[model samples]
Target: MVKKQNIPAKEKIVSVVLLAGLILFMAIVIGPGFSEPSSPNQNVAEQMLPAGWSAVGGWEIYPKGRLYEKINGREPLFDQYGVVRLRYASVSKGTNDFEVYFYDMQTPDGALGIYLANTPSEFDELELGTLADISGGQVRVLKGRTYLEIFSLAEQTPKDFLIDLSSALVETIPTEKEARRTAVELLPKQGRVRGTLILNRENTYGLAKLTDIFSASYQQDNDEFDYMIRTISPSEGRKMIAAVGEEIFEFDGEIIQSETNSLVAEFMGKTLILNQTGDFLIGLYGAVPPDQGRRRLDQWIETMKDQLHGSGK
Candidate 1:
């Protein structure tokens, strides 16, 4: 036996809440789309390389069943070169990030250079085996092997995509050799200096020692012998004549010239020129000044001529 009573507004509210919960449960279990899994295609273009820049030359396209415009010499984001690779992946919850890996190329000695890793925690992490950094909206290798990687937390546009690709391309291109040559020229020279000798290595050039023989000195910093030895072969005499044309002098039975501020003696047998441009000595080695030295110089010149002819023979 029960007395029927009107439900209060609060009770009605409770009933409504329970009914909504049941409806939600039914929707979860039997919704029309629930049985058919939704396969949304990932918009990779919006996720990777920027526009206009194609991965030309040395790159491979990835992902199965997808078509990409072939850009020669272009590479994938994870590709490697010269024992280095760049790896990129989107984070599930945290900030976007990527990594750089450096590996030692196989060496004959069997000792490997260390591996390096760079990650986002340090942002500029430089480990023994890897190095990585994020800059200008791109993750680039400053010191480690592989050059650059561009990814996006936002949609990737063609513009952004090409920006990354261009970076990689720029990194891969060979540096100009002239710049390297100039750098080498700027480097200090170091070597031993011997007594002055005509360095006729292919051409007659002069070499004067700035230091004692076997001593070390920087060529860039120290003064070098003025002229290289002129001729190594007697057959090269005509060419030498052309090279020294009209600058010749007839002294001690030899044709000599003063060119580039140094006396150039050619096929001379006697009477060496002692024209002191300054205090520098130019006579035959071990010979003193004036007449007595002149005789010795003449003899020495004859010996040189004989050596040259014998070598040719």
Candidate 2:
């Protein structure tokens, strides 16, 4: 048996208030959808400079408009990649000194674009961020919309310290799927060479007219060729085909009309085929035998169409 005692109104109100406070406290401490307070991001470059290092003159910010103040000749390259700004600093730890550069490329794809454009042909690699490249004493990383570089002073290569510093910055940026998704979305699943996708906002294949293109290589049945895809209207596509018909750089090729609006060109022992499918311009290079090149190009174009329509396997 239980006995009930009448409680005073004031005490009852206080008890209810205390109970509500406890519930709120628990929700904040161990609840889903609640995040801990975080340090401000703009200054993260300084806060995450690693344990034993310090920026020589603090971090200097250079907006896109003023980037030329810091890097006169290279600003155009970064501008093409959609860089939003840059954070520059010189860091030193014990006997090692480094020049650090942090770039905000505005989007993950932009970050990846600049990273790939600058990647050296031969270099050691690091698994930091989305990916990192180490050439000599310099290291570059692409993380979400951010790209980081650390250049060794006096040609001194302090590999371990540079990695540690990069790790600290990488942890500050949250992971984003844009860079990863671009490769998967724009390239076919089969024989895509995995990490070979390059989002080119600048001249593609050194063709000034071809910008904002996605390029990758495919290898199947011991045959390899480069494929490119870009958003283009039918009218523009026809114009590009006409331009290629006249001349494709040093490759003097003869353009032959294929299907309705499709065209094929064979020159200098290389075959090039291009067509406009819906709002996309799809093409192939290094594929020989005009018939075989058209076949492979058509197959890849179909795959890309399926991907764009959300029916890709």
Candidate topping lDDT: 2
**Candidate 1 structure quality by residue, lDDT tens digits, 212-301:** 111112122232222212212333433333343343332223444544332334433322232211212223322123354445334434
Residues 1-313, model 2: lDDT tens digits: 8999999999999999999999999988876433322223445556767777787767777878777777789999999889998878888888888888889997766787888888777778688876787888888988778888878886667677778877887786667743224442455657877557677675556555556767888888877887877756667766766665555544555665645446677655677777766656678877567788888887766655544432111
Q: Residue 138: error of model 2 in Å?
A: 0.6
- The residue ranges of model 1 lying beyond 4 angstroms of the native Cα positions read 1-73, 76-88, 95-134, 148-150, 155-313
Q: Please identify model 2 stretches exceeding 4 Å from their true place.
A: 1-47, 50-56, 92-94, 106-113, 174-180, 183-209, 212-224, 231-264, 275-280, 294-307, 310-313
